[model samples]
Target: MTLSRRPAHRDVPETAPVAGPIRVDPRTKNLTKRLTAGDIAVINHEDLDQVSAQALVACRPSAVVNAAASISGAYPNLGPQILLEAGIPLLDRAGEALMTQVTEGVDGSVVGNEVVVDGVVLAEGTRLDMPTVLEAMEAARGNVSQQISSFARNTMEYVKNEQDLLLDGIDLPELRTPMEGRYALVVVRGYHYKEDLQTLRPFIREAKPVLIGVDGGADALVELGYRPDLIVGDMDSVSDATLVSGAEVVVHAYRDGRAPGLDRVESLGVEDPIVLAATGTSEDVAMLLADGLGCELIVAVGTHATLIEFLDKGRQGMASTFLTRLRVGGKLVDAKGVSLLYRSRISGAALVWLLIAGLLAVVAALAATPGGRTLYQVLAVRWDDFWAFVGGIFG
Candidate 1:
């Protein structure tokens, strides 16, 4: 669900030009963390995937200027279509020079089809509309067969290299938080994660699953008022505040034992953070960590939100994700599926219990009042007299 993918509502008109301070980043995920409403995003992403696209949409950027082709026709990438649907104008293939020429935090404008910086026109690019995106998607679909072949080969290659994940699980850090035979919810800040997590509030409450946040996903849990028990990732995106929020941190290190995320967490005063050196994406490691630790049910939020997205992320990391899913498939349920199958609605048994509790409360309150004692005496006298009259008639 790279749900790193998304859909959002925007107030700006599609045809109108947008202006604001520009934010520059080659990494879309990092850019999202700092983006403010109305800021123009200057990115170097090529064949922009759904996850990165959705992230940009969430920041409510005025416009996105890509230094590379947003749709290279390599695959039917969903990013451009989502941006246009949200009414955020996309200036595609503005060229690599755009990254060097424009400085961050400078005033910029997306006028007509060109980028204007301080009244100087830096570059013009293809303004993607819905029709154009649709055409590109259709054409890209034709190349899926070729991509499928390449994807399989790449996945097998990784499966050989990272076989340790399958045959023998990597050594997981000892934890104070219990995950054994319990439901574990792993959150990623991807595709409709906010909406999906909102819907799963009931499940979270009743199940009381161990909350695991993967990198930036920890911020999402905090936003929803759920403190994460274990935070896992390269430590690039999770906030300093969240890192120090008493949750045990697991720094995802390279197989070679280099952990860049460790210094940041330690500097923030997080004590005794465990380092798990593993190959593959942080999200993959997060899933394996839960399953290997004996979690009975591992529900995923914003991680492969849907099957299409799962297939769409057919890059190098997808190979690891594929193997990790195979190992955890029995317990792994997508977050959206969990929300739909069950809701927070009260059961009949619960209603009956509530009714009984209410009646007991009323009796206790009435018995405590002085006037209630007088009423009770009168009722008792009337009950005795009425019973005597009925006994005489029966006799």
Candidate 2:
């Protein structure tokens, strides 16, 4: 054995970087399900909406690195601004390489404007500070007209083919939950859904509408200490715990008989789930189900009601939503953004007037009774004494 082998060099152990673990997800909503505090969120989202932004803020991530543009100059997307406002560092336009290369649970650090993974610089991006987000928003605002035109054209095109399906109504399976002639509260995890749900606390207490959760809305209901009576959606965002919480499940599938969520429902041990193969968004399906099932009134929360909100979602499927609203018609009352508008059904002034009217009525009734004159003298004497006592203290 001739030559002596050289001693092998000892490899130094890599030190752990002072940063949070990175969680990579193309779908922000899905990532949020597992995201925890002080984690780094790497999302592949373009034109991030307000709802998504709020969800991220709730998780309180250390930083956010986006493979795609968070704003994208696509109609003043609010997500980037929200993240910045929440003090979460946002690195935008880091490209696809970062997403493909960085595995979940890797240590991620933000030094200046670069995203370093395990001490290696994975990507560099524009740090979205408040000013940057505002400027981007302003530019995005200018493109609103173009976006609107595109939305309209897309809606018209889709309606030509999907109109029949929407009008025909869903052939819903018989469910244990009753809906005829009762108010239905259909929730979607859309814009400010939590706030809207909280504002409707009194109404929910009084009406006791059938709690219908669309996808993640099921989780939303559970968060607010209410169990959904019916869970409807593609089953992507709905949690397993909520699925098995004794609520009737309605699996929303594609109109062409392709039901991806069905497999998930079955896998979760949810038996007897009604598979409704219908078109449009899950929220639309929920509303249509309520309307078709003879729900007297359907109150929608966290749905795309405003024009700006519709555009913000940046989905072509909004055409279905537009038609679904028309289909639901007068019975549909959108409670999205309701927290901004609703302070009280009865105003303070009105309540004061009502109190005065009642007091006057009571006084008049009491004065008209027998022994009323004697009682009135006694009250007048007491009232004078009370005022005299008060005056004595001051004077």
Candidate 3:
């Protein structure tokens, strides 16, 4: 079945009680998944890579089962982690079929962590409701299995550049944790981030922490309400206007100790110190800034977090991402789909207004064109046939 183009749960309350718990088992088929009024089936494959965070939010599932190595390799996405932290139970290392049993048993639980599933006992040792613990375990598994594969494949490629590895200028700065009580907004340019900045207006007016943007995000922040405190990345996505806006600039450099983006900054004659030469992508640098600046919370938006997302960008520098998260640990918050969570509740009048606007636009356009006039004429000729088909259905 096809879903509607618009989000179905747009009117759902931000924090509603999940309907009766659903039962699932990732391993077996004999086990039947339970269905409650609010229960939803979440399959974590690289599906997280294929869909937008907002799309997932629209489903409004009470919990999610992550089948993928969500916390593994060099990828660290802020979306799922944020969901977990927000009290959504995250179950990884479980297949869809097996997890169905777990969801079904959520309502009946006690004695240690064993969740009773269809008279079967699930140990607390395996099931998880906390985000941080689940993420770490998933990462450890991915690292042991995937990291070894990654090392073996890329080992020989760097044989010719042995000396290049010794360069100091290109080394990533030492990681630092964000300070207490301050929040940092890390921005990236993505679909609708510019328009979505309006959503941050409330947060900005209230929390007002350090504002840092990655490349184009700096420009985006400037367009919104707040001035950025720091700008990190290669400086390519950022604008001349943003560069001169007096924010501190940090340029990501090649692992070989080259400052590729420095010349661009100089061409613009930007006077602020551009910390050149760092490892990883710009988003990685933005995270590092939060860690290094001592900000209490790191709120990232429009940033890429999935394997597909990274592949889409054709990234070659995720090494820094893996290491950066290790430094920041648990304080990172990804606000990717916050807008969808707190979207303006569309009222009856507003939807009516939208329908009227759409109809008017179509009518006006049709009236303005001869092709449209011809199409309307054809429709008029077919009106009898159309009504006949409709009448025949009832008859």
Candidate 4:
């Protein structure tokens, strides 16, 4: 009954699928006791996006608690979860302090089968009641305010000297602002964004925000039925259609003005339009573009702002993201958790079918052997007829 298992380790160089920002949970006990505000708590994995990371990092907890399972337990997540690489200590066991906070938050936030944000329970189990949910959301907003506030303040100060490293050899594209009072959705490559776009479609359809995709995110947006307004990045992971979607194209380049992406876009017949030469990651570029264009709100998708996520992308530090946050401070909104907001369950019928298929296979295999030879012979009076039936199925 045991299924064949693949070895946990493989020698071959396999192409791993790109996933969204790594999510890690804090596992330290007595968080209130062990951690202080402005402590620089590098969360192991919170499934947070760039803005959230910035907000959390801004809190500046006393020390980072890398509760991310990978660093703590080698449990795989989307990317290498952040805390360990951020010069933060990795906590293996969920200590009393951390769990106490999570429990208190959950209890104080919930009533009966419902989760209460403020005094209202948003949902009972899986069904959402928006009124209650909204109340909870409002309450939850300020729960992490101190952290976010500190992160913003600290990052702004930290990046002042590192601006050149962030802006090094990068191009700043000339952005054309066609609409006012509109928001911009900046897409970056990250976890389940493609699948989550199904849920995001309604938001896009309703908000009608200007869509901007960075590199592979350009293709991701297209896959999710969104025609990007402006595709920005090095053109490394985008498609030709995304580049030529008639939206303003901005190529993020090094400070040297020598963009590797420029040549590819040109070869694709995309003429010289606009390219922003900067020294940061494309997500950073996208945020700056949104800011420069005066977008009222910038909702980010799959963007990485954590030191771990930046490091996992092979960058040594988070200097660029740190600076970008200061530039787009209040207007930024991270849509990273939009994916984990829903719960899906297997249907009863599906379970029934699975059980039936498994039983049928076992019965067939058993009947084929000496275990049920007499029964098999009794069922197979005519071998030719059985063979014909099998052949007919193939036909």
Using Cα atoms with residue i matched to residue i, what is each candidate's TM-score against the true structure?
Answer: 0.83, 0.82, 0.42, 0.46
Model 2 per-residue lDDT tens digits across residues 166-278 = 56776767889999999999999998888889888877887889999999998888989999999999999988999999899999988788889998889888879998888
Candidate with maximal TM-score: 1
- Residue range 98-117, candidate 3, lDDT tens digits: 44334544553222222233
Error of 3 at 265 (Å): 2.2
Which stretches in model 3 have alpha-carbon errors above 4 Å? 1-181, 337-395
Residue range 1-395, candidate 1, lDDT tens digits: 00111222233435678899999988888898899999999999888888888889889999999988998887788989999999999988887877778899999888766788766678877788899999999998888777777778988998888787877767878888889989999998777777888899989998999999999889999998989999999898888999999998999999889999999988898989999998888888889899989999999998874445755565676788888888788899998889987775789999999999999998788788998878878899999999999999998
Q: What would you estimate as the lDDT of candidate 3?
A: 0.55
Q: Rate the local accuracy (lDDT) of all candidates.
A: 0.85, 0.84, 0.55, 0.54
lDDT of 4: 0.54
Model 4 per-residue lDDT tens digits across residues 175-209: 56453578888887654455556666756776788
Question: Model 1 residue 17 lDDT?
Answer: 82
The lDDT ranking, best first, is 1, 2, 3, 4
Q: 2 or 3, which is superior by TM-score?
A: 2
Clashing pairs in 2: none
Which of candidates 1 and 3 reaches a greater TM-score? Answer: 1
What ranges in model 4 sit over 4 Å off? 1-173, 176-179, 305-310, 314-317, 336-395
